[model samples]
Target: MILQALVDYYQRLLERRTEGLAPFGYSPEKISYEILLSADGGVVQVNDIRDNTGKKPQPRLMNVPQPEKRTVGIKSNFLWDKTSYVLGISATSKRADKEHAAFKSLHQEHLAGTQDAGLKALLAFLEAWTPARFAAPHFSEDMLDANLVFRLDGERTYLHERPAAQALRAQLLASQAEGQPPLAICLVTGEPLPAARLHPAIKGVSGAQSSGASIVSFNQESFASYGKSQGDNAPVSERAAFAYTAVLNHLLRRGEHNRQRLQIGDTSIVFWAEAADAQEAERAELLLADLLDDRPTDEQEAARIRSELEKVQKGRPLADIDPRLQEDTRMYVLGLAPNAARIAIRFWEVGTLGLFARRLAEHAADFHLDPRPWKTAPSAYRVVLATAPQYKDSASMDDAASQLVGELVRAVLTGRPYPRSLLANALMRMRSDGHVSGLRVAICKGILARERRLGINSDKEEIPVSLDKASTHPGYRLGRLFAVLEAVQRLALGKQINATIRDRYYGAASATPALVFPVLLRNAQNHLARLRKDKPAAAAGLEMDIREIVGGLADNFPRSLRIEDQGRFAIGYYHQQQSRFRQEDGADSGNTESTEDHIEETQA
Candidate 1:
């Protein structure tokens, strides 16, 4: 009964699909099978086909008559779909990590068989299976988020059959099953051999006068020398040999039984245990047709389906828009090497893609920042600016200029500097409303090389006004302006300030000439904080420090400045620091020292 049930089930599955069975061949009306023997070489027993009236016999026949006379044992094997089975492993975000945590834990569990067997088998297969890698190894959650993985053996045996075999089997089973003469049935048991399209044979007959070649076949290796002679290669010949042998073995075994004729038209199709000849050739010369259990060959449709499937399984880059940018503006920000990895961090702290686009849109007028050019490359956006052209000459254009200021603030906070080109444009713009202050001039000259790079022509056109205008410009505040200018100057001057000014302001007792001053002004601010909090910090001398400040001035003297010019600059910086300290301390010196007295002594 079980044998008949299995046959019925197989017939139903074959009939359910018609993909590769249609074009090539004739159909078989009846299938006859020889007994399948067990491992012990004895016949394996199974139930027989249902009798008429659709009722199974009460005492199932354990041994249906062996069709070919010689008693044979039963062999049984099960078939399954490739798509129905799955490997139950998943990857989750909470897993420790790739190194000592996640994969290690999983591998250990897999080795122990504690992990699900299906999933483990699938993972092992994946580690060895080269094809379809692009579709596997994606992120998933445990128990909740399940993804399909292919396993070798677990619960059910999944048969990887050729499309033609799968299709032909389905078509024959589709027609109503009647236990008539044309459709004979038999029962057998024992697992089927492992699936393979080809195998080698030990022997075959060779022929001479028959127009057909009667060649005695031998094991695959025997033909190697014959194949490699002054003819084709051994490997190719061996493959052909194996395939022919396998086909012959199947045909001879299945054709052991015979006798069935079902007439559809002038052509009389006979369904029996096996096929005697290739149907196409036999049809041309004979009266009756014999069906064989040979491979049904259809290449194109299978190839097409596989091609489409592969295309659907590939990975693609992610793209989406955020709420911040409503207008159409694209910006590209490039990071420097290691910084590129922290793109997400920058996004969260600053803004999303939309936020960048919106900022560019908002400042379109002043900076004339257009974002269209940076849509790709550098992989992430960093500091890019753009603006609309219409507001190029507006007085409030400086408002768009605030973006530059914000960038500067970020620079100070991060202790990184912007590129020279960006710094130059910012300074030239800032100088527009006022005389460039001493600090601003020094910084702009030092880092940007603005005067050197932009030249006099561009400077006059780019800088809006002099330092006087800058001090009073609405966008400029005193303290921020001073800090920004000092920072730029320190950066421009090879990160060094005059030793005397460094000691006086930053309290560096061992100030050396040419020492790169990383954060002079910042250090000064810290010193001021110490003073304010009444911290026990070493006090900075005002006069001797003033002399060293002059000495340091000589060290930073630009080539363009004459001796007289240097004298004036030294006096200016000294007085500037003094005035700054006085304000910080709120100490009033009613009578200020004469500038002439200080100058005369310095000159002497």
Candidate 2:
């Protein structure tokens, strides 16, 4: 299904020239250097094609013919290859004579008897080529690794771009037609076509080899069954294999202003749609990418996102926003991760374009929380990072983080319940870090709310978006009490203390409150006494708040809390803390007004 969808999308891209998709029998490959040659085989120059603006070389893409299969033995391509083609340098360990003999023979077979000037010049250059003379002054050690393209008589156009090169390529393929793979029923196309012995390597996946990695491969004899070998087990046709691989490589290509791929943890995610209208597909892809981006480039894009989200929320038909998008256009999102020499499929989803947009909007609504100073709707990456241990690098997250991210994205797309581990991990971080961030709180609330709506935990009270003073959950009231105690300490110390009660006892209070709250209340009384001396009214107000929270609890603090209750505890604490900040700001403003009135009376 994945391969067929890719092939369909590839056909759509091919029909539109504006997409810059490579045509059949060719692909966009990065060529780092060009090898210049004269008609008489003299070395003219070696030009570096890499951009110098960045630390690493930025090679531009060239529409070269598909590269031939290279192995340990010496094999020559028709017009373009590495240093072996232009500088007569062989990459194999065979005897120097044998290597040069093979290179000369392959070039003579392809370029001989051709009337084109470029082909004749190229043949002449190869006939006179020798390793010793070629390596004297023009060839350098670094040039050996760079990809080389030939030029005849210092012409501005590359040899591969000349008219004769295409003819030679067609001739070469036609002669080798008898050597093609055996016919088999293609699983992707459901037709009898030549089966690919080996699928092309896939690149742009994070953590994969720089050269590339394979999605389907079988190397060991034990793994093969019923005499099938390599890609024969899957039975994908060569054309279908090329189509799928080409579309994926185009999606993964970098250096573009707006990329179609995103790296989340160890996974490389790519999204596309099979729409009749190419512009509609492009616009939908861009919208999805912008919505999932953690840090959007600017506020204007954010505002645009909000506007589109509102349209989705109102049940607006997709065609109403853009007439090009029909209701049934298929969309695909694939997530891949590196696994040794192969690629692992993390998640795959296929649905209609309208359903995808609606589900994505639902995901945004799920993450919505009270207005946060940091961000309105946190991205999937930020939500995953919230579960990491404090002061630790996110790159060091264990396998659990990778699993959580994959499952989270799947849930958003399919409208399924988030992984149970998500709630557990978020609470674990909050306990260990002694703090709950805005992102973490939002995740907890989203998970718990969904669990309630699904009837998974129907008996428990629904967790609100903010602090609910009227609720009577023991864990929640305890969290509120803890917040009040911390506020008292902050007010008494003028917010300058090195550490407060939260830093020392948050984990203990949330997990084993029965053992910690008795001692905390005693400390809070002393803090209140100090505040009463300087600011009696402020102390009284804090005392009443603490009493109201404790009064709601019917019994002593529970010895321990369940995982669901722990989430409520974190949300309760976060809400209470934010409320305290609001109250403090109001108090400061009232004090300023009172002082202004006193100054006016003194002046009168």
Give the best candidate by TM-score: 2
* lDDT for residue 168 in candidate 2, whole number 0-100: 72
lDDT of candidate 2 over 355-469, digit per residue (tens): 8778877776665554442433555666676677765323244534876777888888888888888888878877776656666777887888777777878646867766689
Q: In candidate 1, what are the lDDT values of residues 9-32, reduced to their tens digit?
A: 233323544221211122111111
Task: List residue ranges in candidate 2 displaced over 4 A.
Answer: 18-20, 36-46, 52-57, 90-101, 135-142, 154-157, 162-164, 174-177, 306-329, 392-400, 587-604
Q: Where in model 1 is the C-alpha error above 4 Å?
A: 1-150, 153-358, 368-604
> How accurate locally is residue 428 in candidate 2, as Cα lDDT from 0 to 100?
80
Report the CA-based lDDT of candidate 2 relative to the real structure. 0.74
lDDT (0-100) at residue 278 of candidate 1?
A: 36
Which candidate number has the best lDDT? Answer: 2
